[model samples]
Each structure stands twice: as C-alpha cells, then as structure tokens.
Target: MGRSRPGPIRWLWYAVGGRLPDEYREWVLYDLTAPTWVLRHLCRAMVQHSVWLLLLLLPIPLTLRIWMVVTGVSVGLFFSLAFIEDASERRLIRQGFPVGLNRKIREESSGAQRSELAAMYAAYYTTEPDV
Candidate 1:
C-alpha cells in the first residue's frame, strides 16, 4: 500500500518475494514476473493486521503501535487495489482478455489442431484486405 510506510527490511522482503530483484531496473519485467503469492501474502498481512486491531490494539505497547498502523494502512490499501484489479479483470472479460483466452484455448486444444486453426485464420485474413 502506497500510504503505508513500511520499514526498509519489510520493503525489501516484499520486493524479493514479489520477484523484483532490482528496484530500478526493468520495472515492467519485475511486475510481469511478480509472484501471485506476494499478493496472497499481502492479503494475509491485511487479515493479520485486522485481527491485531481487534484483539491487540488496546493491549500492545506504544512501540508496537507503528507496526499496527502500518499494517492496518497496508491492509486497506491492498484491499482497495484488489478491488480495482477485480474490476479490471471483469472489464477485461467484457472487452476481451485475448491473451488469457488464447492461453486457455491453447492449453485445451491439440497442437496439430491449433496449428491448423492458426493456418486457416492466417490464410483467410491474408486474402481479405478489409480484415
């Protein structure tokens, strides 16, 4: 969560777990390579923080308050992003997540059949200038 200020070590942990080896290099590649597990980890953190807020907030030491706040903020932000991502996925479904659909189709189709379909589409489209 952008609003949550994690300590350097925690930040590094997230970076590493997310498969972002370097902060400054190939940002897109890092994102593409990011593990879905990291998101799940964040979700777990969010839930853990909520439980802390409910069960430990009043009893924890002041020194621990910072952690509680950061975790709580991070949880809120993570859920927000999750919602946004879900919305985007739904939108992609409507407008077409072609790459995703293609992957599914490829996985389900025989290689020879897939190749034949590809060839047919290529041949048909190549002849149609409007296409």
Candidate 2:
C-alpha cells in the first residue's frame, strides 16, 4: 500500500455512502509494520477501535451520564494515534536503520525506501531483550 505513493495528506481516504474518511492508509501501514510486537498490537487497536468514539454521541441521546467514561476515552484516543506514530520510530532503532531513516521517508526519497518484504523479514527477526 505504501508503494502506491500517497500525497501530502495521507491520513485517510473515503469509502462508500458519502465516500468519506473510512479507509485509513498510513495508520494501517503503521499497524502492519510496527517494529515491536507490542507496538503492532497497539497500533492495530488504535486504528480498529476508534468506532468507540461514537458512544459519546449515543450517551447524550440516551440520557446516560457517561461524562467521565466519555472524557477518559476521548483523551485516550486523542493521544493514542500520535503515540503510535512516535512508537513506530522504534523500528529504526530496533532494526538499526541508519540515522535519518525517518527523515528520509518523510522527504519521500525513493532510494531510502525498503521493500515491504524486507521490512517484514527484519520484523520477523526482532525480539525483545531479556530484562
């Protein structure tokens, strides 16, 4: 998917109905390619579980006083996506991607890009250090 080369606004795309904001690109890629096993699970959760945000709208119409639950979930999601992106950098640290790999990708340098298969191979070999 990343090989298709997204634009500057690569956050998401559209689907059926109104055709808006249902398909996620970068988030999906991150979830799939997360450097650590923990990060992969975490990123997947952030992308897949965002539908819970709609519960806030339900509480208002249902006369449910869910302010605390709503507020906490709101804050959690607000930080979760950004946290996942930050955590993706650990891939570089774990696989020993040379310095500035993140910058290279952000710069859209084709030469700096690794094939998805190669990345998957590296991820397969990554193991947590014994503490």
Candidate 3:
C-alpha cells in the first residue's frame, strides 16, 4: 500500500504526540524508520518545544524573551535526546505498532552499514602478532 501523509494540521498534532488517523499509518512507519529518523525526531521535538516562543508576546524585554525561549528549547531538546528511543517507540505504539518495533526496524535497516563499520573497525583496531 502507498504511504499517505497527514495534512499540515494533522501533522502538527502528530508532531506534538497526538495520534494520526489509520490512513497515515504507513507514513508514520516510514517517518520513524527512515534513515534520517533521528533528525526527524529532533525536529519534532523542536516543534513541540516551540511553544516557548509564545513568550515573545509578553511585555518583557525582547532579549529576555529570546533568552527564555532559547533556554526552554535547549532544556527540552536535551531531555528529548535522552529519551529519544523510548519516545520513538511510544509514538510508533500510538500509531498501532508494537513496542520495540522501531528499534528492530532500525537495526534491520542499518544492518549492512553496521556490518561494514564492524569490519572496518576490526581491520583498523585489531592486530596480528608476527610469528
């Protein structure tokens, strides 16, 4: 079946932890499993934290508002990174995928690159003793 994306409004909701309709299940799978999934996750986290920007509407000094938004986003990003795997899995689950499926799919998708890296590491880091 073809992957179907949600509309912008639906996508924003999805980005902030809301569940998408079943029609976008394939797109959600692709989103969480694609090669750049981590980056995509971080982008979603940024969007989630961007509510801090609303501080700009406050009567506070411009610099203070900017700093508050920056600090809030920075802290949010840090926590997001710390819980990225769990969060990704939860998002997948919300979309009807089983738990741990994200990690399995990621591992399977990167198997070739991972094997190549292991081979390269062994070649560079292992030494043979001369007889």
Candidate 4:
C-alpha cells in the first residue's frame, strides 16, 4: 500500500523538527531511506534557513541584509550537511523509530552499490602475495 503524507502545514511543522502524525509515519521512513534522501534533507534545511532569514528585516541597507542572509544560509547549509546523519536520525527517533534505524535502512537499500564498490576497492587496492 502507498504511504500517507502530511499536508503542507503539517509538512512545514515537520520541516521545523515537529513530529508528524501517526498516519505519516511510513512516509517519514521512506523519505529518510530513499535514494534521494540527502537531497531531501538539504531541501528541508533550506526551508528552515529561509524561515529564519525572515528575521533579517531590519533598518539595515538592502545589500547588507542580503549579504547577511546569504552568509547565514551558507553556514547553515554547511553545518546541516555536515551533521545530516545525526539530524536525520534524530528526526526518525522523534517519529518513534529506534536509534540507528536510518543508517540500517540506508545501508540495506544501498547494498548492491556498496557491494560493487567493495569489490572494486578489493580488486584495485588489495595486494596479493606472489604464488
């Protein structure tokens, strides 16, 4: 069966670290485990940063405000990407998933690619003694 998704308002709340309803739990797992999960997470981070950017409406010059917003978003995205695993895991936990479940799901989903890479690494990097 297809998973149920949250509405826009619920999604906005979810993007800001709010827990989703039980009906959306399966969708949340799929979202975090899908191949495009990293991109999805980054997109959510952008949404979060954009919301915070709204606070930059001060008496400052337009160029200065723009520069500050840009800088803030850049830093936020960098940190978000840096800590993506932790963030995603925390999100999963908030939705009633166990710790490390995200990693487990990702690893399982990418098993074929991982095995292929491991084979390539063994062939290219492992040294064998002369027979």
**TM, every model:** 0.23, 0.33, 0.79, 0.79
By lDDT, the better pick of 2 and 3 is 3
lDDT of 4: 0.76
Across 50-127, the per-residue lDDT of candidate 1 in tens digits comes to 544553556668768767777777777667566644432332243223234333334455645654443343343335
If both were scored by lDDT, which would come out higher, candidate 2 or candidate 4? 4
Cα error, candidate 3, residue 21 (Å): 1.0
lDDT tens string, model 4, 2-103? 467798999999998999886677778777777788999988998889965774788889888888898989999999999999999999888776678768
Instruction: Score each candidate by Cα lDDT.
Output: 0.41, 0.43, 0.77, 0.76
lDDT (Cα, tens digit) per residue for candidate 2, span 11-42: 23211011112133233333334344355445
Summing lDDT over every window of 10 consecutive residues in candidate 1, give the lowest-scoring window.
Answer: 24-33
Name the TM-score of candidate 2: 0.33
Global CA lDDT computed for model 1: 0.41
Error of 1 at 103 (Å): 15
Order by TM-score, highest first: 3, 4, 2, 1
Q: What lDDT is obtained when candidate 3 is compared to the true structure?
A: 0.77
Using lDDT as the measure, the top candidate is 3
Q: Let me know the TM-score candidate 4 reaches against the reference structure.
A: 0.79
